[model samples]
Target: MKKADLEAYRQRLMLLRARLCGDVSALAKSALHGAAEQGGAASSMPIHMAELGSEAFEQEFNLSVMETEEDAISSIDAALRRIEEETFGTCTGCEGTIPKMRLNAIPYAPMCVRCAEQEEAH
Candidate 1:
C-alpha cells in the first residue's frame, strides 16, 4: 500500500476503535444499571410472572448485544495493532494485498475477499 493509503487506513482504524470502545462502555453501563434496578426492593417484591419473564428476556438480549459489541472492539484493536506493525491492508489468510475498497467497507477485515469467500465455503 502507498504511504498515503496506509495513513488513511490507520486513521480509519483509530476512529473505528474509538467508536467501538464508546459503544462497549455505554452497553456495559446500561447493563449494570438495568441489573441494579432489577435487584432493587421493588423488583424483589415482584409483580406478574409474565412481567418477570419479560424483564429476564430483555436482560438476556442486552447481554447478547453487548457481547457482539465487545467482539467488534477486539477486532478494531487487532486492526490498530496491524497498522502499528505496518501490516494493515494485508490479508492474514493469503498474505495478499487487500483492496482499499474492502478496507473502507470493513476497516478491521483481516482477510481479502477471495480468502474470506473460501473460508466461508468451507
Candidate 2:
C-alpha cells in the first residue's frame, strides 16, 4: 500500500477510536446512574420494576456495543502495528497480498478475501 493511503487509514482509525471511547464513557455513566437510583436508601426496588427493566435493557445494549467497539479498536491497533512493520497489506493466514479493495473496505482486515471466505465456511 502507498504511504499516503496508509496514513489516511490511520487517521480514520484514530477518529473511530475517539468516537468509540466517547460511546463507552457515556454508556458507563448511564449505567452508573441507573445503579445509583436503584441503590438509593429511599428507593424501593419492587416499585421501580419497570424502570429497572428498561435500565437493564439499555445496559445490555450498551454492553454489546462496547464489546464490538473494543474488538474494532483492537483490530485497528493491530493494523497500525502491521503498517509500522511494513506488512500492512499482507494476509496473516495465507501470506498473500490482501486485495487493495478489501483493505479499503475494511482497513483493519488481517486476511485476504480467499482466506477470510475459507475461515467463514469452516
lDDT of 2 by residue, 14-108 (tens): 78778878887887788777678768767445466787688789878877887888888889889889988989889999998998888878988
Write the residue-wise lDDT of candidate 1 on 11-95 in tens digits: 8777877887787788788878878887777836448899778877877887898789789878888988888898988999989
Candidate 1, superposed: residue stretches over 4 Å from native:
43-46
TM-score of 2: 0.84
Scanning candidate 1 in windows of ten residues, the lowest lDDT window is 37-46
Q: Give RMSD (Å) of candidate 1 vs. truth.
A: 1.8
**RMSD (CA, Å), each prediction:** 1.8, 2.1
> Whole-model lDDT for model 2 versus the true structure?
0.84
lDDT of 1 at 80: 83
The lDDT of each candidate is: 0.84, 0.84
